[model samples]
Target: MGKNTWIALFAVVSTLGACAQNDIRPTVRISPPIAPESTAMAEATVTMPPSGYLDYCMRNPAECPSSARDATHPEPMTPLRWAELDRVNTMVNASVRYVTDASLYSRQEYWTYPNGRGDCEDYVLAKRKMLLDRGWRAETLLIGVALDLEGLRHAVLIAATDKGDFVLDNQLEQVVAWQETGYTWEKRQTAANPNIWVALTGDAAAPEPFEAPATQPILVANAHGAESKPEVGTAAPAHTIRQDAEHAESTPALFASTTDAILTIPTPKPRPLLTARPVSADTFSLSYTTETPVIDTAERGGAINGAS
Candidate 1:
């Protein structure tokens, strides 16, 4: 109501406004969510199928047809289908006793359905057969070859589903995703034709180009057969080592004095240990006279009689 009161109220409003304007809060930066792990493997160049698979196909014509299927694609995986896969994988793994082809049939390699005992290939065939009997498509079930953790050849049944590719292995009881198997995939049956195989490109990358060392190290060997690298100059300019006698003789002489000094030089080896020279008869007589006392035979006899 009074002038001073009104002035005080205006001052309070201005102070509040300035405080609100000056207020600063820390800014938070949120990063985008991390993407899910990739679960699929890509097919590379087509290649030859395994020899054992061909033999098995020859025996069973109905299973391996030469013609390609039109509706070849990944099957949509459901809970029931997943359960069925697990059941087949576990049952076959338990029932079959692992026996090598050499021990079982006196052959190096063979692929066939297992009765009670069989090899890895046989176990794969038996699982595929059981899955086929349970109304699964042939295209969905693919036979795969891979190198195990120990880098040994192995066989497994691959189930191609919408979610991801899963492996049904004779060595494992649980149906596992192919990516988590830790095996280097080599080849697998193509979806178009069960008999034809294609190479798998799983996380394969082109090798990095080789780079020359920035500074060449000099390796110095010790008396105890151990070697050490000493700090040395940078690598020489790109020049080929002259193998010819004329160039080899000329290049080394120039290398030491050149502005761009070569990192390495051939160390001059010391002459071999001084060996005793084979002496002639004259030299031998001279050497003996100089070093040893010479006495006449009569004098020597006289000295011997005196001693006696």
Candidate 2:
């Protein structure tokens, strides 16, 4: 081969070798995706109160009670005197008339001491005010929301006493323990800081059992092919059916035989051939005939052949 030809062949081979090396290079790999950690732990650590109450607090900053703001001051955790608690609860409940914020202030939500009439939250605020006036620490008294027996949202004043947490409700005449109200505890203001609130854990009380709905009993056919009417009101127990069966056994044998005869009578078999045949395009006739017997006036008292 000529010198230029050999040089051209060598360059082509070098290019091919370089291309092969590039094609044989190792590929870059990517790691598989990983699932994110759960947020339940975060939710457990940080909690908040109801959105409605928080929004009200933010909008009516001026209406925030002075006691709530000064809740941070150290106070003795002394057991609340029962007589004092009862007095304060009853006095505040009677002093305020129940009215809604919309009806009283022409606003959606407002928290303040009621002059004469106010809503549930208003009653709570008024009770807190009275208790504070009576030298009770602000932290001991809190405003909370709970689901009433009807599952409706309700607000009440919770007084933290050494005996237990007692609720002062405007709907009730007297104070009651928090657990006895059958209310679902949602959230409450912190004892350490009235301005802050925390989520309540654990089930409250189960709702009361409701009476079973009334139902109409289905009509059933007896052995004699007659429908039996059931008595109205609550259903009879299983034992009642046994008693009825026993009572039926004491019935007359003739009636029992009649019932058995009615039940045991086999249904008449269908005719082997149809007795009806078409006679004309517009009408048809039955092959069998039913004859009526003639009666004379003198023989009217005589017995008929098919009479039972």
Candidate 3:
């Protein structure tokens, strides 16, 4: 072969060998981009169970219902299921009488499904058990804590249905929509995982610290119906107003200013007039005159003669 031809053949062989080495190297795989809608759906679906419920489950694992650990998500609720939910809620509410945990269990807080008489948590657990037995998915039946209409801490069973979330409260016999319950939801069991819980967003966030509402200044009235103003330098006495039972038990007394604390100052009576002076003669003066008329006898005699 010619020298140029040999050189060209050697260069071709080297290029082919380099290409084979490159082909033998490991290949890298790239993941597909996640869709925004899916990401949002995932975020929206994520939830957390109540802390009390979790603690109860941990302490009494055997007592914990199977629904708590069930990973299967519930199907959308149908009309039949909705009717069943109402019936079950009403049945449980009517059957169980309201009683405090402290009175029954000798503890301040206990979560259990009571047999005859029980408190709020008991009512929630009983309803959950009945629904779960009726084939409702555990994920759909969530136990949550919220402030009731009276701003009291209460436990309720939240049924996540296709229609919307509905609340079963012991205080109310009707199974009302969750939004209509007037509750400030705090935390609830995750729909995906019952063992885990997430803090609820928006209204579910830890409630703002309870602020005793501003009290209007009360006006103190006297026997004469005259309102008296408080003295400038006097400090108003502090009045303690007991808040709702939940707050009253957990928090300190809320201090407020009341009219009862206002000091009453008696009005000074006017002094009677003591000095009396005599009236002067010039102050009361009067003028008077008397006169008499004489009779005309001569004229009378002339009238008598003319008549005769």
The TM-score leader among the candidates is 1
lDDT per residue for candidate 3 within 232-298, as digits (tens), equals 3333343222112221112112212221222222222111111111122111111111111111111
Better of 1 and 3 by TM-score: 1
Q: Which residue pairs clash in candidate 1?
A: none
| Candidate 1, 183-301: lDDT as tens digits | 88888877666745678887532221112223221111112211122113323222111122221111122112212222222222211110011122111100111111111111111
Candidate 2 C-alpha lDDT tens digits along 113-195: 56676677766766776677778877668777767766666778877653346677776655667766677766676654443
Ranking by TM-score: 1, 3, 2
Query: Candidate 1: where is the Cα deviation over 4 Å?
Result: 1-38, 204-308
User: What order do you get sorting by lDDT, best first?
Assistant: 1, 3, 2
Clashes of 3: 7
Model 2 CA lDDT for position 157: 83
Error of 2 at 258 (Å): 92
Better of 1 and 2 by lDDT: 1
lDDT of 2 at 177: 70
Off by over 4 Å in 2: 1-46, 50-52, 55-80, 202-308
Clashing pairs in 2: 99-118, 99-119
